[model samples]
Target chain A: MKFQQSQEMRNLIAAIFVGIFSYFIIKALTDFDIVPGVSYIYNLRGPLIAPNMITVILFDWRGYDTLGEAFILITAVLTTGILFGRGVLGGDVSEKDSTPIRPSTIVQKVFAAPLVFIIVAFGVVITLGGHITPGGGFQGGSVIATAFFLSVVVYGFKKNVFNLSHNSLETLEGVGALIYLCLGLVGLGLSGYYLYNVGADLYPYLGVGDTATRLFSYPDSTNAGIIPYLNIGIALKVLSGFCTIITVLWGAEKK
Target chain B: MNGSEVQFWSFVTAALLMIIGIYAIIFMDNIIKKIIGVMLIGDGVNLVLITEGFKPGGIVPIISEKLYNQSPGIFQEFADQASYSLPFALVLTNIVIGASTLAVLLGITIKLYQHYNSLSVHEIFKEEKI
Candidate 1:
């Protein structure tokens, strides 16, 4: 009875149960024959919208789903802001100053500034080139956010290259979300649907041809339509959302 | 080497990940460890999804300009060789959601630590009048 009541014994029993459950799951999944249809169709038709299949799928085919996912991120950021926003929304009289803090050594400071620029540049490239490349908004946004974290955590939010404030970050997030919403609204206006690929001129309902295409499409080899613009919106939103969360969590004291 | 072999191994890896995650969630006393376990579970499910999209010998789902310029028959061949991309899109969205959620959870954890001055789950849950 004593042994059964112990944490170790509880762990063992839990492990055994999970193992048995997964064993059956694995067997069923392994034996099942998956006949895929939508993916095959998407592979054939995906390039008509964009050369990159995954990007097209995320931004064009299932843009609604992605919108919901983005809302989840935005909501989470707001939740964190609420959790740590003691002086932010309503609290004490606040005056904020950027702190001047040096790294332990001269060599570290010299490298940090230039490296941050390089990282931000790389993230921009990934974000912009997402349509014709492997990356998308999410990956590129996180890459940029990583740079923000490095600089803010190491050099304190007072880096010589850039200064970030909560208000500015919130504005960026709002603009990002507005971009996405407006793009969808344009689709609704043109083709009577949300997030229709107007650049493709693929939809039968979108009777407006060359003129519409010229107005909306990204200046690239293929007509990725609103996808690239959507990528930019998502990247900006994600970058700011993450930055906001970190700033709140860091609980920067006003000097 | 082949489709089934790769699929089976991937499933096994996913199963192992989930089992470890479950154990960590149940056995570990630290809130951070439990959060880590939740992440592991998410990763395991993502692996299973991506593995489902794999083929025996498949290329990336991207179509290059050169391939597009090729004859219609060649383009069709590219389609046949390419892996399913829907799961990849799902995984990408999930990754972003997971990261943001992790940040939120950790922020909450920090506040809890400040209040309780303890990271132990047992201590956090101990009966206290207040």
Candidate 2:
């Protein structure tokens, strides 16, 4: 009886805490207006391009972290391939049953085309406006990868998204990673730090002040040049890397 | 004490989440549940790091009116202010990493499900060990 009473008391305390938290969260959102745009909305005259700041931070200021993220995806893909690749599929009746018996959904087929087109268009927008706006390589790449995922789920893995087979995706992923490394090496070769402003010396092409004429007194060299290239490389690498995992999982027979 | 209290609550919530995740990993029988626990732990750590970046009574890191005295041609002081862009960026990158890790785990789980009809984590090891 004592144990049951204590358990009930604990549950009551937990419920009270949760209620308090929910109340505060709702109050903050409605009364305090503690929204995501607090940085801008509460205080007028925030940066005109807040999202651009978001993008630059993702790709340039914190490029090393982005590299680490890419490595995580790569590691996951590699691990998946290793433990559950062809070796596991061989000589197993269980594997044969892994393939889905259900046909493709009508709704999926209807939405897949538009979804792929829109995502690809979004990727283009990100790639083009990355320097000036919030979207960048990682964001664009993920968007592109989502298209592949949509196609696979909607039209069956082997039908529409055939270009990115498991073997092909693996190869693309390796190439994507290599491209990122190459861009970083370019920075180190010229600027002493990996992924450093190889773009600074080369910033003028993107309409950033020419490094030759104006240093801009900014502590770091202008990164207008290679930042775009880095963005593209990263976009390709991440896009392929994400797609690779999704493709493999979709294609795999269960056993 | 207002902002400080907020920070304290945030930290406590993060810690509690982490503790729950640790317990889940240790006790959960299913591999998928274990993966979810790991993700919970990652989210808790990320929340702590994000909360650590917030400065009490500090204005947004953006070059806005809050930092400036609004006097004409007096932008010198605000130029040196620290920015919150780094933490925001870290959160985005961490999110991507977390999602990718989850995808891989799901893939593995699918394969595991194929090999064994059940999702119980320990059973696979037990059957394979002998």
Candidate 3:
């Protein structure tokens, strides 16, 4: 008993140590700033004021990287699908996740229902406003996916997720990916650059920017005309990719 | 701390977390632990990428009319956007992708557990070979 207690104490100590260390480290870093050495690198201007410099680099300067990233998502989804195969919703396992923790109170369940819906709505709003703000499709989609994941945890398979079925998820994923690819193709046709910017004005249809300036006014001259489309394509593909993973994992077959 | 300090500490925290994550993967026998470690590493890498673009005390690259009030007579064009926004956007996408991959890996772990009835990586490998 003493040994067991000591081991538990050690684990608690370790956890506390790690937590404290992380806090102090972050605090220290945030508190410190260097004198003006790299301001020149940081001072370059782009078409929009972005939350971070990396966004400018990815979409405006090195857009091809973004394209590669989109492809990576495509590759991962394809690989997972191919390896796991379709028709995964049913398998021969006779058991279900039947361990009963304290059953949810009716009041709790009712409260959760509206809470989940509100959270999902928030995710949708974030994704829609991605171009204008810090949140984008991936973050929004993941937030949405989290709601689904959380619902599964709270309500379990037999109660909460019965409506979504496996097939709907697959379809959503496929359509999402196809839309991403189509957006890229549209960019190519409009600006001679794959995944070009067809701004908000081109609503519901893709159109090249009327007056193209070199991206960031840099002489490198890549992605000069295409950036917005890339962002949209990325958002769509990421959302789809995450949702697809959730479906594949949760929707598998069980007897 | 100032901007540079903030950047430095964030980088250090990220690095430490990454190292711990790698160590967990190397030492922990549990598949779940390994997956968690992988996630830590992913997060750390994302932090590094994001930090790489920071110019201490630099502002975000969005343009708004309010900027004229904040820094009167500053170039109107420069106030709106910064050079760093593009890379930041890309990194944001990457962070999302990394998170999804973690979710997928966790799903795989669940499947493995369902098949083997155990979480031990060594045991799973042995069973697979047999």
Q: Which candidate is the best by TM-score?
A: 1
Q: Write the per-residue lDDT of candidate 3 for residues B1-130, one digit (tens) a residue.
A: 9966777777887778776786677667798888888888888877766776566555665434465345543444453233344345556667656765775677677668778888888678873431
Model 2 lDDT, full chain set = 0.62
Model 3 lDDT on a 0 to 1 scale: 0.57
The per-candidate TM-score of the B chain, in the order shown, comes to: 0.89, 0.79, 0.78
Select the stronger candidate by lDDT from 1 and 3: 1
Residue A54 in candidate 1 has what lDDT? 92
- Among the numbered candidates, top DockQ falls to 1
lDDT of 1 by residue, A48-161 (tens): 788889998999889988888888888888888766653455574342433445454677667777888899999998999898999888778878988888777567775534
TM-score of 3: 0.66
- Deviation from native of the Cα of residue A92 in model 2, angstroms: 15
DockQ per candidate, 2 decimals: 0.53, 0.19, 0.23
User: Candidate 2: where are CA atoms >4 Å away?
Assistant: A1-51, A86-101, A105-107, A201-223, B1-6, B55-83, B125-130
TM-score of each: 0.89, 0.68, 0.66
lDDT of 3 by residue, A47-112 (tens): 233322344456544556665666667667755664365424565333243434457777767777
Which regions of candidate 3 deviate over 4 angstroms? A1-45, A48-64, A77-103, A150-163, A199-237, A251-255, B68-83, B127-130
